[model samples]
Target chain A: MAPPEVHHLFHHPIADHSFSADRGTLAVARENNVELYGKTGGKFQLKDELRGHDKTVTGVDIAPNSGKIVTCSQDRNAYVWEPSPQGWKPTLVLLRINRAATCVRWAPSETKFAVGSGARLIPVCYFEEEDNWWVSKHLKKPIRSTITTVAWHPNSVLLAAGSTDGHARVFSSFIKGVDARPEPSPWGERLPFNTVCGEYLNNTAGWVHSVAFSPSGDALAFAAHDSTVTVVYPSAADQPPKAVLSISTQVLPFMSLIWSSESEIIAAGYDCEAYRLQGSEQGWQLAGSLEAAKGRPGLQDQREESALNMFRQMDLKGKSSDDTKLKTVHQNTISTIRSYEESGGVVKKLSTTGVDGRAVIWTL
Target chain B: MAAVNWRTINIDALDPDSPANFDLTSLAPAVAPVSTADVQSLAGHIRQLLRGGDSEGALRGALENPPYGADERGKDVHLATIIEILQSIRQSEMSPILSRIYQSDGGTEALDVLMKYVYKGMGHSSSATATKQITPQATGFSQVHGRGGSEGGGQAMSVLLSWHEKLVEIAGPGCIVRTMSDRRVV
Candidate 1:
């Protein structure tokens, strides 16, 4: 319609923001709490606050078909919560592991989700009949080190997890009627249709914090703490990902990466500015930068009582007690960018969460 | 002799109950019966009296004396509920009511009340000898202090209802007894 207006709904100053595929809604995993936002009119409205993590939450993702949200914290527990019609209430607390989950992603179908902890990547599938969830058998490789990000392919068939070692391996779960190849392993398990691959991409020594795939299923984009965004193209021609786009820029460590719908542009969210890339030769440029609210240099430079007071004064009303208060549990500026491709392709939407405690929804 | 002394001066001796020219409502809490300790204390005392074969005397004393517990900002039904509940628990002889009351308000206020009641009730007594005070533990009442077995039967309902009535009575008929256990209660 209008080339999608970019609006930064909020600027909460924290550490980071993690987003989901349905850009209409965003769940931010902050240091203390997780926040959910819904797109209303042309802006993002605070929809829910999911609490109870003993420490800072590191990642968040929303399940499909419903508003069920999953978040992982440094406190070593990952919880799955459902938003109540009345407010943002936690429905169920899923698993509480003894390790911190740095990254999380829900499968394209939303039936299951995955998490990255230390050097291990754990994929948990929800069993409706059992009313429980179990870790996927395919992810039993025991990588032996820290995994920074986990991303499920759009086809819901492959899952790619990246780590500090600069290796991003793709795995296939081989659901029935899919990947029915004969058993290849010693146990006749056909190796589960899952394979591991690694590459020593130049200058990828630091932790790979973000992993994403092009909407077309052709290319995979990853950003590492090395301050580089690396795009991987399939070596084959049948829908092969051609051309590796590596853009190096000196901003805050590259926290997250995403590809535009057409796969023509790549967006990397930095600490201050969001970088956009056309290709390696063209290099990377700042797409959009968040400017502090006019009055002060800090988060709430104007003499407001508190962030909560500022939020209350905005007349922000949600489904709960004083939902208007801006004092959200998770306060952080967004260091990530993503877009949702609607069914009819009529609308392409963009949403973001940041450390400043703001979730902005953009119309594309 | 008294008349001569009055002339000599007795400004310090003022009539205690003389009709005061000031209203004292300002010195009082907006409502009464809000304290857990007060309700528990009154409940405990009445419970003791009822257990000591003074049920009729205790009820009569409560009706006449009307001891509102620790909180002075609650309604009259709080007192009523305390009296009613003590009477029920004494007659039922069920100890699980403490658990019910403890969990009734999510255990916030009820536990406080139950804790004080149990502590004071069983603090001094012993069942082995008449000379020794009967303690809850000495009476072989382990259910009251066990981790999961503390729900005391109908006594829980009495405690809750008593609290509800007291809040309504003191804070006005519309006053709701919000258990300390639940922040959502208004």
Candidate 2:
């Protein structure tokens, strides 16, 4: 495998990041603003900044087809940035959420988006052509706590959300005039707004951190605070699931996860390393860490150290060894993992941003 | 009547995260409550299993039906039996026994119950040391010649900590989280 490409953009943490369809532009949520970085001379260079939110920006996602950027912030606000001749223009969305918005994701069709918020509800926003504004309808029933993450199904109608209440729920976000009637699937046939298609609680009832749908939209997987990843295959609309496989690992809890294909999921979080889990409805197990084994830099320094150097180091810093750096590529918690490139429903490369202010691209 | 100003109504205030909104007792699983006599008999059975060199059976008996609904004294009695069984097992046999227990039916719940007792035991031992500190001065002159009592306490504490670590290795941190969040006492 080739070495991962690392980009240290700044010192501050990156809460989230998204790449444009052509992968030429990157939108990152940094502190209170969203920074747009364009590929210039094979490197990402800051091109513009969108400053509107008063608090920390939590999420940023770009529509794959329309090239539109949607960002959510802790200020209980979200904005849709549309590119124009002058510059990128911002249009405030009527989320109608009182608490901070935690995550945002655009539907595959680009006609709508979902914003997960701390207000114990999700506001599915769509364009209102006659009103000349973006309006939202809330999915409020049965959500007992703040939503931590949200994912869009392939059909763009069914939405999956993970919440602090330890439930990963799938709700139909179908709008009357916005979305076409989706084909019947295992989730449900009569899709209505706020129709809870499935509600699954983790085995230990730990806080759900992230959720994702398979490429076919037939399966759902969620990572919880118990360091367990559970996969659910719904048999039908209202029946018991065919299988619920829980894969527990002896690692720190995952904060974010993405499905690489129908049977493989890549998750990263407090461990600062992405781990791959591969299986089907029958079972799932942790394949291994995606990080390649590399010798530690500190080990080399210790090998080169001598008695004189040890005494000099003790005199200077009163410590025999310098252990500030970590062994892994990422130094802190990996906050977000996005599919950098994919073809034929199989992700080839992944991009991850960490609290250490570095965005790394890894090839599978 | 004047038209109501809905925009200024503060919708969040209507659905605040108040204590009344959460019914924690509802989270407990429905199980038959255990009595003091039931706990004493089960403890006796576990001790018999341990005496017969069936440590695994003793562990299973101790973990199978934790006194989730028993009184504090009853639960403590059962916990003591469990701690004794845990201490009697050899380090080399811990992993195999844990793996077998995990593969059995209702094993996850049993492990969760064990984890709860392990944590409670650690808490008691630590608090016991705290109280020991206060009484040590009173008995300092008598114990200055021999520090065996405190050393034994420290060794027991280490044993409990290692058991906690081994339980996490086998059951994952989910067991600990579940035990902490579960409202039912053991």
Candidate 3:
């Protein structure tokens, strides 16, 4: 995980966030809107507010290519909003799943996407468009359970979702029709196949708060409320369950998990400090400690006073006043994370929604 | 003579077998061949077998009968009775009698019976008397028996209409059906 070097504080706690695939633009989720930030002058500057969600926005994702943005909200709907030449406009509201989506991810090809929600009745949904209209598939099970997060396998439509019960399920759908006509049920019949990816066992333990699959589909990373982050490799059968690394960080109800560079590094955000894994070790070794937004030494005393005033008033939803009290200590809560692909694992950006009511972007 | 539990039996006895037992072989004459024109008689005969009222005579009649027709409606009734008896055969003390009907009839009757009432029981038609007028026919009977004994004719369509058609083409329609697709000798 990259060290928190530049802590950009937001006014509200960040419900969720995403760094553009090219590292050019960043999007943050808030109560009913998303804020776009531009990376400049060693910090993030608010570019624009993209608003359309009727309720609290829980998750936001940027397409790998077209810069199209898709956001999910507690209102039980996911919408695709594009930054058009005229201005930001809602492109299409993807079919609604029956529950609030905890997380969403775009396929590497950016053609279709998966949405995971809290309702087990329809745990996951896939979206695609044929002819000129958009359509979706609601894949439900005879039995029900809640799904918390979803991640698409790199370069493939394979989807992996983390459930509240601490199980991770993999789903694959095949669409035979090409670009010519509408393909029937892009999310095909659910295959009767899944594996017990991980378990939350101590006391009440914790379910998987976040899940991520490696770029090559060989490895998996899960951050759970069990105060531990588990890394697994599902490619090897016949081998016993392997936990590459475990962390003792106490992630409350919701945690964020992400993969860095080559998937060899795993990054996670908890209530307090965010951590990253650097090797194939059993226990996660802390790479860097998060620091707060500080007034630069080069600035004049008056400027520093003004900067401190801004930082003081800045309240990211997940962090407390004490956590934000000092200019040298990064707030304890982290809502989201993004790894800059081109930057050689140097600055991992941390997006934290603080108690100050802002979406803060930090480079760690 | 001994009480047999049907649920515990191996998958083989779940259907009929060719090697007849003494008890079932003796009642073959009473068993009637399900026909093509009407399934009411065949269903009645199956009713008698289930009642144990005159199963020996019923089995004897079944052996002497020819085969049933493939009219969808009539097959439905015959299938219902076959499935009901097939499932309860072990408990009836008429296992031998039921087994004989299943075997000589080629699993078709047994399968239809299983499909109709046993495997997926009927829930739609609540009134039993509503189905009384249905006549049983032996439309695809020859196709079932033709597999083992070497009968030559066009293959008849099995219950699984689509899959059976493909199988007949693959198995040589002439040696399979005993009748052409139009019911005329080819």
Q: Scoring each candidate complex against the real one, what DockQ results?
A: 0.00, 0.29, 0.01
- List the candidates ranked by TM-score, beginning with the highest: 2, 3, 1
Q: Residues A107-169, candidate 2: write the lDDT tens digits.
A: 998999999999889999999999988999999888888999999999999999998878899
Give the TM-score (vs. native) of candidate 1: 0.48
In candidate 2, what are the lDDT values of residues B1-186, reduced to their tens digit?
258887787654565563246664443345567898999999999999999999999999899878877888888899888989988998778878888998887777778888888888888777766555554345766465334445656777778788787888888765776676555667
Docking level of model 3: incorrect
**Where does model 1 exceed 4 Å of error?**
A1-26, A37-47, A83-97, A131-142, A175-194, A197-200, A236-245, A250-252, A280-333, A340-347, A362-364, B1-186
Task: Give the C-alpha miss distance for residue A154 in model 3, angstroms.
Answer: 1.1
lDDT accuracy of residue A153 in candidate 1: 72
What TM value does chain A in model 3 reach? Answer: 0.71
lDDT of 3 by residue, B1-186 (tens): 258886676653442322221142221123344444456677676677768856444434432332433454655655555444433433334444534543453433222222223212223222332244233654576445433332111111112233233323332222131121112110
Ten-residue stretch with the least lDDT total in model 3 chain B: B177-186
Error of 3 at B97 (Å): 77
Pitting candidate 2 against candidate 3, the one with the higher DockQ is: 2
